[model samples]
Target: MMGNKILRKIVATVKSESKGINYFSHQSTAADSYVYSILVDETSDISSCEQVSICIRYCNSQFQSQEDFVGFYATSKTDSFTLYNLVKDSLLRLGLSIDKLRGQGYDGGANVAGKISGLQKRLSDDYPRALYFHCAGHNLNLVVQDACQMSPVIGDAMSCLNKVVVYIRDSPKRWDSFNTLLASHEEVSGCNIRPLCATRWVLKLQSVDAFLHTYEVILDFMQTAHSEKSNSASMRSTAFSLLRKLEDFTLYFSLRLLQVLFKAVDPVHRNIQSKTITIGEVLTQVSSLANFLASNASFIASNAKNDDSVAHFTSCKEFASKLHLNFACVPRGVRVSAEDYFCGLYTGLFQTASESILIRFQAKSLQMAENLRRVLEDESIEDGIIKTVSEFYDDWNYIDILRERRQWFNICRHEGLQPSINSLRTQFKSELTYKLLLPNIRSALTLYIVIPATTCEAERSFSALRRLKTYLRSTQTQVRLNNLALMHIHRDDFIKKVDLDDAMNEFIDRTTTRRNKFGIGNK
Candidate 1:
């Protein structure tokens, strides 16, 4: 502060001594040309307490603010006071205001609090109008996790599959040999080899297929195993069974259900632009998907109820019926009015029926008596039952349309449909439900497709963090890091202060050149 005061006095004295130049005036005027807007988000590794955060700020002009390293601090013992003050100080120095904040985004997890807690809530307490959204893509992924956990068989199969994948992947020679074997089977060499990854679903499907194709080779390699030396007969049998179950799961995914879900969720992704998707549309898509899943779930549940001899399973018929009714409750047309029964006018139409409908979900019986009969009756390819059922399972696109012949094959194999026995019936119900509910879902999807609600926005925000926060690697404090991270993330909105020195230099050069020309009588 004292140095700045002394500098100001010196500059003023110099200006007073000058006769023609108004350097300060030129500097002040040039500082007001353009505005830079900034947005911000922060990431921290809480485990190690080796805390670091990034702040990115970008101007409306060419200089986009980014940082690779913004702040670093030991989190093991730091209090919130130090953290909060650090951020405040950094922003103040950068000439950013809490008021200038346009938007905020985060991956709503325990580490990063939601609207109710953490940075967003704190910022909201300060700047009320700051637009905040949870990343939509992240939400979608969570939804997938929820859906998967609902079935234990699927959970186990996935676990076993992961184990096999890890074993093979750990050995390069085994993994390569496995691929080589697959290459020899078909014209396409090793085109089918895919590594199993935990979170990636699409890639996992190809990996499952690769594993199944090279099962024999894998077993042979495993015979000389070291890590899983306890590969007993039962373990081998379970692995093979799990492999088939995975195949079934993959087959089920190939159905249009997952595709439809993707389509439904595509809109409402986080990044806000001019385009916007409406709530009405999102609701419609949800209703359609719900109706479809409910029907299938209902059918499976109902079938399980009929087979009282089987273990625990709840019938979802009531929920399916209720959701089906929900579809009817949706209002159609572009200008949907509340008064319109199909739109929202007849909101009360579903009220009466909604109360009575019950919600039930059940696991279907995989085994059937009739499926056993077909396998015993015929062993040759000429026999219709075995041939038909084998063909059905082999076709990836067949979905769940199982003919009676396939049921006969299951009976012969004595394989109680290891997973969902009511698949065909469930499919029937789902297809019917899909047909009934598609119009509404489609309309809603079309409406919301223009707006992204998924966490793709969160991914984008993190991408910026990795780019900025580069310079302040070691000395960067956690609070400064957090503030800087948020600032640079939203830097696009921050009005960057013009560099007065550069502006003054340009101004002096132009002014001097003009004066010289005028003196030469060239004005």
Candidate 2:
């Protein structure tokens, strides 16, 4: 009894600090636990960097506003059935129903996203409304990984680059020397080297950029290090190996090509990680990147030839333009021709990346998201737009509901509220909009808003998990770890809305009985 009382007090204090004043007072049964962690934007205002919250959308007695931070659980197994059970149990604990679950978002892993018997498939079988979305960031990362592996030269270049990063980063002396050398260079001063990580999608860009920026500095350091008698044989050998690999024309060209290609897609990769980014926006970004790559591929094919001299001239010219150096300084004796480099390797890399992106993100849900955006923003009301949306909802009559809501949509347009798809969705949540489009259109819009475009929110939570449960605090209780993560991740909300006095009072009330029985007085 005493332990339970203390635990409750701790939970209350954490919740109050993380959520805000009166967080528990309005707490109702049948809360939507899924909303608490998913990437659904719940506010009227939209910003790319808006902080997302774990909110519960409920309607037991009456439709209530979104609630924050219900609970968190820890599980070991990640199998489909086990994950499904964990979700079901968490909802049950919160007095929420599986029938109310509207959306789910996961990375593009076979376990979670597999088509035949994945967790998403299993859950969809039971609750068809729980639409599953592949995390846009993960999909992009996979696309890059797949494309990089398509060519032996590109793959070898990446592998050698990783080795160089690891060698420099692993040794303190080498890292310090590298930094000192970088400081001497005018163009690359104050730039720190970034190591590549296989899992982190954004780090690849930074790593490649850092390497390219410090390319000359690194070569000088490696050459100098290789000559020094004080350096270990292994270090000297590794430096010599990396130096030769970096000096190769094919490797350098491939590196520069990848840097440019990834840079074009970086904006899209970043946008999908935002809470405000919608499905339509993600599709648009991917399509734009694909088109950009296709156009570049065509240009390279038309302009560049298979001759070694042309390859050397083109590569050197581009390199000189970027670094502001003379083309005459480019090293001679190139092994690969321009045609092979551009038409053979660069074309494959670009085409593979573009194709992978299109393959992953081009789906019926994406089409529906696009149609929704068109309907809201353009007021197109095209013949097939209604059919597309109806197909999304698995209901033919959904088009009728959309037709009935046309007046409300016109009202929003007249009032100048329809700025974007997201803005339209935000407006649909208003009292006036709800009353005008009441019941049917309102429900449909609610469903649309709840459908997550990416699993960025969940991925963001994992970052919090790492911080909260670091090596030093590895043994912390799962519940307590989760509590701390909630507090840390949602610190903005706590800082703005949480009342310290209210939290203290709640804690006191919960612990008072136990304290009194133990003859402990309030300090």
Candidate No. with top TM-score: 2
The 10-residue segment with the lowest total lDDT in model 1: 360-369
What ranges in model 1 sit over 4 Å off? 1-90, 114-117, 192-523
Q: Write the per-residue lDDT of candidate 1 for residues 1-523, one digit (tens) a residue.
A: 2222222432232222211111324442212222111223334442334442323222211111222123233444333344445545655554445454433434554333344555655665676433344433344445544544443433554566567676556568657755666566564445544445665443344555554445444544444443344656665565555444333422222221233333333342222211132222333343454454333333242232212111111112232243221221222343532113221111111121121111111101011112222232333324454445334222111222233335434543574432222332233244544313222221111111211222333345445545544544635554555556545543442314435555445445556675465443222
lDDT of each: 0.36, 0.61
For residues 121-222, what per-residue lDDT tens digits would candidate 2 score against the true structure? Answer: 898898775667777787788888878888777778788889988888898998898888888888999887777777765558888888888888887888
RMSD in Å for all candidates: 26.1, 8.2
Clashing pairs in 2: 36-54, 305-339
Clashes of each: 64, 2
lDDT of 1: 0.36
RMSD (Cα, Å) of model 1: 26.1
